[model samples]
Target: MDKKPDHTGYWRTNLKYLLILLSIWFLVSYGFGILLKDTLDNISLGGFKLGFWFAQQGSIYVFVILIFVYVRLMNKLDQKYGYREK
Candidate 1:
């Protein structure tokens, strides 16, 4: 009989990271970009309003960073669970 791959723990960890990253994405994209735009616009970044930057560029940068972070985290998790591919 073939043994099933035991990945429940790994799956849960991945889900948790996904949720956390998504929450941050939402907050940066919507909260700072729209809801708090007026307040954030007072701050300046590279000759642009902070709020505009978040909506246009900052959130994208953060998302890219999050993707790298997720990859690193998952790799570590895989190693911990002996699930790393050769």
Candidate 2:
């Protein structure tokens, strides 16, 4: 006999992860890259201004990283729910 998984808990956690990750991306890309560009410009990264970096390249890097992070998180989530691929 198979026990039912707690779908409610699973989806709740998934949504939480999505919101948090998206918020972080938004903050980095829009907040730092645009709204706070002037302030961030005071700092530098690899010869480029921090703000410009985030706007031009940093956001893309962070997004790719976030993709991997989401994958790892979902993998663990699936395990927690006894989800397995056939």
Candidate 3:
């Protein structure tokens, strides 16, 4: 007989993924882009100051990437928890 999946563990893992991903996003957008702008401004990326890039476009790019990452993570999680669509 197939054993029942642990819903608590599944939920906990899902939440952990969310917290980690969001924290990364926040660090990049808020910490690097705003709080450390001056320090980042000293560096360059594609001809633009790193801080300026982050402030204007980096966060959006990171956000889109994070969305894809989340989708991928959730897919694996779903499969692990026997929740994936056949």
Candidates' C-alpha lDDT = 0.89, 0.95, 0.93
**Model 1, span 1-86: residue lDDT tens:** 85555689779888999999999999998998899989999999999999999999988999999899988988988877778576
Tens-place lDDT per residue, model 3, 1-84, is: 987988999999999999999999999899889999999999999999999999999998999999999999999998888885
Give lDDT: candidate 3, residue 7: 96
Task: Give the clashing pairs for model 3.
Answer: none
| Order of candidate numbers by TM-score, starting with the best | 2, 3, 1
Task: Name the better of 1 and 2 by TM-score.
Answer: 2
- For model 2, how does the per-residue alpha-carbon lDDT over 1-86 read when each residue is reduced to its tens digit? 99999999999999999999999999989998899999999999999999999999988999999999999999999999989899
Provide C-alpha RMSD values for all models, in order. Answer: 2.4, 0.8, 1.3
- Specify the highest-TM-score model's number: 2
Alpha-carbon deviation at 31 in model 2, angstroms: 0.7
- Please report how far candidate 2 places residue 44 from its true position, in Å: 1.6
For candidate 2, the 10 contiguous residues with the lowest summed lDDT are: 27-36
TM-score of each prediction: 0.89, 0.95, 0.91
TM-score: model 2 vs. ground truth: 0.95
On a 0 to 1 TM-score scale, where does candidate 1 land against the true structure?
A: 0.89
Candidate 1 off by > 4 Å: 1-5
